[model samples]
Structures are given as structure tokens and as C-alpha cells.
Target chain A: MGKIFQKPEALADVDTHYCPGCTHGIIHRLVAEVIDELDVRGRTVGIAPVGCAVLAYNYFTFDFQEAAHGRAPAMATGIKRVRPDLMVFTYQGDGDLASIGMSEIVHAANRGEKFTTIFVNNAVYGMTGGQMAPTTMPDQITTTSPAGRDTDEVGMPIKVSELLAALQTPAYIARQTVIRAKYIRKAKQAIKKAFTYQLEGKCFSLVEIVSTCPTNWGMTPIDSIKWAEDTLLPYYQLGEYKTPNGAG
Target chain B: MTHEHLVNRDKCKGCGVCVEACPKNVLALSEDVNAKGYFPAKQARPDDCVFCAICATMCPDVAITIREIADQAPTENKGGK
Candidate 1:
């Protein structure tokens, strides 16, 4: 075997604290692999946000800054404004980006900040014990919505990529998943494009990763992947919401 | 036979799964810590490898790669490794 798959060198040699079958680990590896391939590991600066992946700063080999909950966009904006030469990105969760950080994310996209954002959407908050997230599926049971999320009561899940694509400032926006190899390959391509857009000085690149929360969903690791595919994909729909070359 | 090993010194976060994933007992915790100050995973035995890339595949980081050791010859290429 001439080494077909392994961890990328850009990642830190530490075990992830994410739950088994959690999509956070997969998303992180994808971003790190992108950095390695782009050869921007040395100049990249990632802003780590609150929620399950708040500790993401410890996983990547690049320089990192821990921002307040729902404040990663602001932090990344400031960093990029000051250090325009650096490749800046933010790693935010659905709870952090779609919920309280909603204002910041919207403004960042509106202002067209030249930064990359890896938005992990597991439909629920995974760090603070599986609470209902803004992206939570209709009737998806969570700690707050134990009887499943009622769309009539809780409203429908917010389509972040679609909403952001509507904004003219953002240069790239995409929604992808990591439940299987076929999707994973596409997600990697999307991630690489987002980074490439950022390197080209394009504005507001975001990759919304429809992820899995095995512990919160009350399913085994394998089952969680299946649930994400069967339940989440129908709503999220993996594809490029926006692209620099005008390709969707 | 070719052998594969994954190394993610910074991404290891000291999870120790690679050490357990190896059936050949070829992996061990490194004594030298990385920038994160975590003991990274290391190859305990390189020569005994049967080219099983399980350690690399099992890695959450996907940080390891299996390579064939060729003598004074160019390495074989793959589509993606």
C-alpha cells in the first residue's frame, strides 16, 4: 500500500474530543487537508469559536485564536482587517453561527470579509449537552425539544448557505456533508474551493457542513451517519450555493 | 510488501487510538511533545510492517500515509494517498 489515506500533516497530533461519529472531526480533517494542499498552513490563521469545536484551536497546526461564543466572525474580521496577508478563517458551530452569532455572520457576509468559515451544522448543540439548534430539523428531538422539534412551534430550520448566497458580498457559499465517501470527496472539493477563493482575495467564503451528533441524536456512530443522510440531506441539500467562477 | 503509518504530531491531541488501532503493535506514544505539548504518536516498528494502512485509515485526522520502501528508486504514485 503506497499510503492512500491518512491524517494530513497540517493537523495537530492530538486525538479529537468529538463524540464518536461526530462530523466535526471529519470537517476539521478536511479543512486541514485543504490547508496542506494549498501550502498555506504557515500563513493561515483560524478563529476557533464556542460550542463543540471551540477547542479546534488545539487541533490544527496553524496559528489560532479562541473567540467568544458567536463572535468568531467578528474576531476573524478584525484579524483579516489587520493582517490582510494572512489566510484567515473561522470554525463555528450551528449553535454559534445560526443562533446568537447570527448578527455577526450576516454582517460579515454583508461586508464581504475576505475570510473562510467552516460552519458545522449537526442540527443540535453538541457541546452543552445536545440542545436544539436553529438548524435543528423539524420534529428532531433535542434536549430542549425532547418530543421532537415542531415546525409550527419552533419554526423551520434556517438554511444558512441559501440565505448567505442571497447576499451579494459573499464570493463563495456551499453546503456539504461527511456521512459517506462520495459526499466526503465532494465536501473536500468544496473546502478546497473555499480556501482557493480566499487566497484569490475573494470575499466571504463559507462552507456549511451538515454534520452528525451521535451522542445527541441518541444513535450509534454508524446509525448517526445514516440519520444525517436520510434526514438532514433532504433539507440541507449538498452543493455549491455560490461560486467565484459563477458555477453552482 | 509496503507498510503505511500516519503521523499527526499536532493533531494527535494525545487520543492514543492509533496505538490501539495497530494490530502489529507498531505504534507508540512519543516522548517528545509537540507544540501543543501533547505526546504525538510514533511508529514503534517500521520494518515489520505488512503495508496495512489501517493505522492511517483509522485515524480521525487521516494524518498517516502508507508508502512502499523502494531502494534507490522513485516511489510509486497513487491517485490519492
Candidate 2:
């Protein structure tokens, strides 16, 4: 018998605590796979954000550092600057990256820091009981926005990839999804490219994965994928927002 | 001759993601529950598996492992060193 599929070595053997159907597990696997493929597990320093993936350190076999809410970029920047040989990446959710940590990410990207970011955009804050996040789509109902997100009052959801692309610094920015197998494959390629860019010391790179929050969104795991495909994909748009030297 | 999927019963959370993703309907939630009190996914129709590995990709818990076995014996090497 020959093995066809198995867990990546970068990931720990322990089971994840993520909610069933939650795409966080998928994203985590992709990151770990990328790390393993790049052979950077020993030299990689991951900064776990203060969100649902806050305990991300417990799942990965490599070195992981905890960061304050929205402060992952700051921590990653410091680590990368001091230890240029190490590959540093930040795993942050929509709330941690788009809201409170907005300035941190923007400035880090603007400075063209050599680091990678895996931004898991599930729209609503999963750990905080599905509160309205900056990436929450317009007319999307969350615990904080029970009446649905009013674009007129709060403005439209922030397109983080596009926003970062518009900056003057040279960075690799892309938006992908992991709702299905096809998208999952593409997401892994994007993550691999982001890490590869960092290894080359090119510039700041980020892969914003438009994910689903089944438990937080009050929908079954299957329905959440459908909803994300219909509502989230249209608004968020999946593609490379920017790439260094015009390479996607 | 065919591929088989091994599901880690205790790790599976009965999410049904793999069940829905399997194009051949090769997997289903078992009636028996695991230690976690959730029905683990099982290979209901192992013969239909095409080794596409879609279920393994969709599994959130990394519970599925696919392996293919060769039915025929390997031919002996005719060339000597």
C-alpha cells in the first residue's frame, strides 16, 4: 500500500479545538504545509494573534509567539528585523487585522517588511461570539449588527488586500478562499507563494483567505460554504491584488 | 487493486464536510459514535473510491488517510548489476 494523503509534518499530532466545519483548520493546514514544503519549520517564527487561533502555538511544531490583539504585524516585524534568517509569519483573523490592528498591518506593509501574513477573513469575529468585524459584508447580520450591516452608516467592508496593494511599498497581496476543494488547492498555492516571497527577502506578503464561520454565522457547515460563495465572494473578489515585479 | 480511506474516528467531529465533498459518495457518517460523542465518517463504499482525495482535503480534522494497494505482484528485475 502507498500513502496518498496525510497530515503535514509542520502540524502537531494533537487534535485542533476549532469548531466543526470551521475553515480555520483548513487554513492552519495550508500554512503548516507551506512551512513544511519550504523546509522552514526550524527557522520559522509564527506570531499567533489574539483571536480564535490565539492558541495556534499549540498546534504547530515550530516556534510560535503570542501577539496582542492586532499587534501580530508589529511582533513579526521586530522578529524578522532582528533575525533575518528566520521566516516570520502572522496568522490573524478579520477582527485582529482589519479592526484594532489596522494601523499595525498597514504600517508594516507600508514599510515593506520582509514577512508573510495569513489573514483569515471569516467576516464576523468567531472567538468573540460573532460580533461585527470590519471585514463583515454590508447587510450581513452579526451579534453586534443584529439589524444587518448598514453600509451607509459604517461604510462598506474593508478590502484589506486592495488597500495594502495601493500602498507605495513593494508587496505581494492576494485574496483566496477555502470553501471547497478547488479553492483550497488555490489557497495553498497562494500561501506557498507568499512564503516563498518572504524566503527570497522580496517584500511584505499577505494572503487574505475569505473563510467561513459556520457556528458564528448561525448556519451549518455546508450552508456556510454556499453563503460565502454567493455573498462573500462577490464583494470580496478572489485574485491577486498585487505582486512584486508583476508576478502573480 | 483499490484505494481505501482510513478515518481517525476519535479525531473526526462528524462535520459532514467530507461526506458532501466525496464525488463518489464513498463516505458517510457511521451510526456508532466515537469517544467524542459524534458520529465519525466511514468508508461506506470503498470500491467506488477513485483516490481523488477530495474527502481528505475537505476534512477539517485531518482524519482521513487514503492509500492504494496494487493487486498484481511486481515483476522481478531481469537486468543484473
Candidate 3:
């Protein structure tokens, strides 16, 4: 065995500020690994959202831009159009994408922007405490929904991937989870494919990764994973929702 | 002295995700805390290690790294040179 596994070079070699067991670190590492694998680190630009991953720029070694809350997709679209040669992506959370930035992402995806998006759906507003989000699971307890989310009043949780897939645009869309080691590999595969689609200028791509927020969920990291597997996974439903090749 | 495994102590938040995923029961959280005040995972029964690499995959902090150094150059050739 010679170097079975090691940290990707695109990632900065330092301790991050993420809470222990937070899957944002895992997703960040996966993106860095994909960037390294594709040899695009030199020309890659990342747009960090305004949520918990706002410090995403600090973790990645490549050039990064901070976007206004819910506006990462719009920023990414502009960057991709201006510098078509560079690889651009946005990292966003549920609240940033499905709520405040819903129109930005929707129109960007509909316009078939060449940039890719990595949407991290932890089901709540993690950065600003456990506030209810558009993707918050029904009957889930959140700071804003202390009595548990009532689907009747707020409507059911928004299925971002499915909603995006319903669009007629030929793009790459996939939903994957990182709640366990087994799922991490699959999630990386989906992420890599999203970037690969962008590399070929196929179309707009969004990889919705169902993640866990241990701090906001008020559970141990392990318990959070179990809770997500039991509660969140059932609703999000992981799979490729769209592809340029017309294969699901 | 060969490094069968290496862990960056500072990088490890000691969430025990790797420990729970290790099928061989090769790792355990140490009693002593690191500089960050978190107890990191250590090899408790290294001989049982199969080097599955799942620990590295599960470690969100990128703390766990697995290395394997063959004793010698690979003897078998599967492709024609």
C-alpha cells in the first residue's frame, strides 16, 4: 500500500472552524479532491454563500468570492459568463438557496448557466441558529418553529432537486447524502460528475447534498447522522434527477 | 519505523465518526485530550487493521490518513509494456 488516502492538495492544510462532525468539512474536502483530480485548481473560482459555509473561502486554496445571502448563483452566473475559461461554482445552504436565493438559483438553472452549484441542505438555518428554512422537514423542531414545523401553515418542505429537475433545461442534477462513510463516496461521485459536466460546458448543474447539522440539531454528531438517515433522507430522496445525456 | 497510519492531531476534532465506521475495531478515543481539548482517536488494536480506508472517508476533519508501503515492488504485471 502506498498512500492509500490523503488530504487533497487543493484544500488548505489547517484546522477549520466547523463544529466537530459537521459534514460541511467533508463536502469541502470532496470538492477540493475533485478540483485536484480534474487539475483545474489553477482556474477554479468558488463562490461562498452567506450561511454557515461563508468561511468556505478560507478553507479552499483557490480564488473565492463572497456573495450576498441567496445570491451565490447570480454571482456564479456572472463570473461564468465573463470568464468562460475558468471553472466556477457556488456552495450554498438550504436557507440561502431554497429561501432567499430561490429565484436566483431557479432562473440561473432555467437559463442553463454553465456554472455548477453544490447545494448543502441541512434542513435548517444553521448559521443563524436553528431557524426554520424552506427545506426544513415537516414537524421538525427549529428555533423559529419551536412547536415543530406545521406543513399546513408553511406548506411541505421544498424539494430543491426535484423542483429543478422539473425544468425543461438539459442540465445535470443529482441528490446525494453524506450522513455515513458509505454515502460519502457516492456523494463525491455525484459532485465530481457535476464538475465534469461543467468542464465540458454541458449545462447548468446542481448537486444537492443532504447533510447534517449537529450543532443546530442539538444532537451529538453520531445522533445527528442517525436522525438525518431516519428523518431527512426519506424526504429528500437521493438520485440523479437530470443529465444532459437524457439519462436519469 | 513505517507509518501504517498517520493522524494530524490538530486536525482531528475527535467526533468518533471514524471509530464508529471502523469495522475491525482498530481505533478508539484516547483518554488524554489534545491541544484542542478533544480526545482524538488512536490505534487500539493495530494488528487487526485491514486498512479499509473507510476511516479516512468518514473523517470530516480530514484528520485520518491511511498509508500502505509494499515491502517490495509489485511482482505481477497485468498489462503488456
Candidate 4:
């Protein structure tokens, strides 16, 4: 009756290394809260990626494994196979999941790995000085794409959620944002649903979050929200692209 | 008197996302820096707070905790023959 909202017990008391206005912290907190609600804190294991979220291990109280660049899905598969009872997830960014590690993730999802994957698509390689990632929006300005991304040369940003949803494997795939409060609610629900699907042992799950890089985007935190809504959301969109047959 | 919040100044990075998300405009980033040399968000108008928790919902750091006052119960008599 006294507490309305507080940090989840599964989350650590340490401050994250994420930059100010970065949504990675929000996503981490959501995952922690979901883990808390599922009562899987003791059994859960997270695979940290090589990008900006490399230090993701410090934010969660659960166990974590640092994987080589773009090898998180492969590592998660190994851990889940040996210990199927343990809940497992991978915290990967666009550069780690959609680009260099695309093969690993594609194969893992195609094989229907029994684990959850949180794909954070901020549209650029943040840790590496905001290089042009495969998910980087066309016509967007990045360090590598100095004169704005050229659609003619690079095609279009990869829609990883939709691409994975096209596979026949029974999996939960969703893309949501946390730019605003309303979006945060939906994003949390999407994440919770992904974890729920994995808990049921029904299928693999991936929640592709369309995030923002305020520092890299050269915009203030508040302005980044508007830019993400005006620029990023139109291309990435939002909604659950796929769900298991029994998922209702 | 029932509604309140504790913002962890040390953990907060002065992102201002929570301040922008507040519906009642009761929160503001402090001009003075904290131990970490970052401006932490604080309640500017506590009486106007409705405890919507929108700030907590949007906070990336999970530094804000919203709470309510709990009612105290009367002492029970022990000498029950």
C-alpha cells in the first residue's frame, strides 16, 4: 500500500555507463522488472553484446556472459542447450545483431532457439563513434554517412523484426519504442510478452526496440524524442510482427 | 502527505527525460550539481504531485521511487483473561 513505483529487485543499485538520455537504461530496467515478475532472477542468464551495451552485465543482478562481437546468439544457444531450465537472453544492439552477427541471429532464430533476444536498434554503431550500421536509416547523418545515408548506395535500413517474422519458425517478434511514456508502456508489454513466450517453452522470442542515440544523433534528449518519432518511427514503425499460434 | 518520491541524485545523470515526461510539471533538474557533478531532477512542487508515476515510468536510470503513507494500526491489549 505504500510503494507505488520503485526499482525492481532484479536490477542493480549501480549506475549504468549509458550516456544521458540514452534509452538503454530504460530497456535494461524493463527487462529487470520483467525478470522480477517472472520470478526467474535466480535462473536467468544474460549475454552481453560488444557494442554500447557491452557493460550490460553490471546493470542486472542476474548472471551474465560477455560474448565476442556478434556471437551472442551463438553463445546463448550453447548455454540454453546445456541448461534448458535456465532462462536465457541476449542484449544486443543493431551492429551486433543486425549487421556483423546477422548470421548468428538468423541461424539461431531459424533453429528456434529456446531463449529471448532483446535487439536494440538505435540505427548506428554507437560505441564505435556512431558509424553507419546496417539498420541506420537512409538519408540519416552518421559519422560514416557524413553527407547523410545514400539509399542508392546502401539500399535501405534493414527491418530486422519483419525479416525475422517472415521465417516459418514459431517465434515472438515485436518492435516497440520507449521515446515517450505511452510508448514505454507498450514496449514493456512487448518485452514481457517475449519473456512469457520463452517461459512457456513454446518458441524463440525477439523484441526489436527502436531506440535513440542522443549523443551520437547530435540532438538533445528532448529533441531526440521528437526526431525519433518524426524520423525513426516512420521507417521502423511499431507493433508485434509475429506471435506463436497459441499466443493470444 | 501520502504521496512522495525519492530521486537518487547519485544515480541520476540529469537526463531530463523524467522531467519532460511529468504530466503535472512538478519536477525540475536542480541547478546545483550532485556528488557526480550532474544535475539531478527534484520535485519543485510536491503539493501538486498526483503520483501518476509517469516520471518513474520514463526514467532510464530507475532512480525515482514513488510512495504513499501507510496507516498505523492501534495497539492490541495483551491482558486478555
For each candidate, the DockQ is: 0.22, 0.49, 0.46, 0.51
Query: Residue by residue across A1-248, what tens digits does model 1's lDDT show?
Result: 25456568888877777764466777888888899999999999999989988888888898999999899999999999999999999999999999999999999999999999999898998889999999999888899998999999879999999999988889999998876656777888999998998898988899998888878899865677678878999989988988876757
Report the lDDT tens digits of candidate 3 across residue range A16-50: 88899999989999999999999999999999999
Q: lDDT score, residue A218, model 3?
A: 92
Stretches > 4 Å off in candidate 2: A1-3, B69-81
Q: On residues A89-183, what C-alpha lDDT tens digit does candidate 2 reach at each position?
A: 99999999999999999999999999999999999998989999999989889999999999989999999998998887846999999999999
Go through the candidates in order and give each one's C-alpha lDDT: 0.81, 0.89, 0.89, 0.88
lDDT of 4 by residue, A107-198 (tens): 99999999999999998899999999998887889998999999999999999998988887847999999988899889989999988888
Model 2, global lDDT: 0.89
Q: Name the best candidate (by DockQ).
A: 4
Give the range where candidate 3 chain A is weakest over 10 consecutive residues by summed lDDT. A1-10
Query: What tens-digit string does per-residue lDDT give for candidate 3 at B1-81?
Result: 133566677778889888888899888888888899998887777767777788888899998776665455423321101
Model 3 spans with C-alpha error above 4 angstroms = A1-3, B1-3, B70-81
- For model 1 the TM-score comes to 0.80
Give fnat for candidate 2: 0.71
